[model samples]
Target: MTVVQIRPARSADADAIAALILPIQQQEFGIPITREAQPDLADVQGFYQQGSGNFWVAEAGGAVVGSIGLRDIGGRQAALRKMFVAPAWRGAHHGVAQGLLDTLLQWAAAQAVAEVYLGTTAQFLAAHRFYEKNGFAMVDRAALPPAFPVMAVDSRFYRLRLG
Candidate 1:
């Protein structure tokens, strides 16, 4: 089995991260999300690392196949953002998605992030199941923290409280 390394994202990883996400967002999900709308892809360190946030990438064979990030929302809360894994690297055998999320949750716990929330489009049925299986509970947008950055395409919401 090939190994996947989960590590903090570098500025140089911007293009790879975007490359990994764009196909899934545009082609797979048919979402209109563009790189222009996600400036964080262009400036991972600058944007995600500001204040109390961080971005991570899953690298395999020198290629970035997955990405996940966290934005501290203050009041011991955070917003999970930009989690995407290459289709070829998904599923339990590869563990690419799980690795990225595990890394993020581990780091969030150490940072004292008591709550983590995320928004997703209704089209992501499998993603909804994945989040639920991993302990995130579905919630209404009104239940989200005031600081949660709601995206234009986000119609479904979920939250996880870390211990």
Candidate 2:
């Protein structure tokens, strides 16, 4: 088994995370992402500054292979966001995603959050299965925020009750 390390994302990890996610996003969306859709080091760094979210990266053999983030949603809940694993690193190491989810769950628990939610595209069937395996259940589309357009078309919402 490959040894994987999970750590809070640093500003230096922004570019690497963006590179890891852009292709996946592009392929899933079937459209070229604009600069606005692509996350940069500055954006991840900013999230650290705001105190409203946490970002983490997974490393194996000293190389970043995956990342995930959690953003606080007012009232004891958090929204899981930006989860991606390099195509080269998928499969049996499913533990990597589990590790990320575990970390986020711990953080949310610390904040007294009772539940966590995530929005993902239908194109990512593997992710849907992963979320379900991790105790998330599909929720009504109307339960999500209005700004989340991805939910209107290809998106599905999953909720994990922490309590």
Candidate 3:
């Protein structure tokens, strides 16, 4: 298996990341509500200028097959967001997500962040297992701010301590 390279996202990567995420959003939410719901990226040029979160893309064979980002939540925590892997590449890309996550955690540690949090729906049971395998523990949705949109009413929140 070829090793996947992880790197900070460039302006050129915004569309690719948006394309990769479109289907997952539709599948999970049953609606095409990303560029509209989020709206910054459909314009492409402005999207790159806005710089969506602290973005990163995983490259293999010169193509981005997976992506993830950390959204600064203020204080000592950052929320993991927009994590996805192309369906065809999921098997070969297991560690790629973890690698991105490990890098994000290292960055959080450097910034003295005490915790990292993520939200996902109950439908993604596999994702829940993956988070647990990586040392995250499930927490109440109330633990997150009410402002954060819950993807599902029963969406689960997970947190991992940086220490």
> How many residue pairs clash in model 2?
0
What is candidate 2's CA lDDT for residue 163? Answer: 70
Q: Which prediction has more favorable lDDT, 1 or 3? A: 1
Instruction: Report the lDDT tens digits of candidate 3 across residue range 32-82.
Output: 465666653443334322222366788888888788767666566677767
TM-score of each: 0.96, 0.85, 0.81
What lDDT is reached at residue 42 by model 3? Answer: 49
Can you write out model 1's per-residue Cα lDDT over 83-113, one digit (the tens) per residue?
A: 9988889888999888889998999998888
Please provide, for model 2 over 3-117, each residue's C-alpha lDDT reduced to its tens digit, 9 standing for 90 to 100: 8899999888877887777777777557466546544345876653244468899998888888988776666667787888877778764578878878888887877777777
Question: Cα deviation of 89 in candidate 3 (Å)?
Answer: 2.2
Candidates sorted by TM-score, descending order?
1, 2, 3
**Candidate 1 colliding pairs:** none
TM-score of the candidate numbered 1?
Answer: 0.96
Candidate with the larger TM-score of 2 and 3: 2
Location of the lowest summed lDDT over 10 successive residues in candidate 3? 44-53
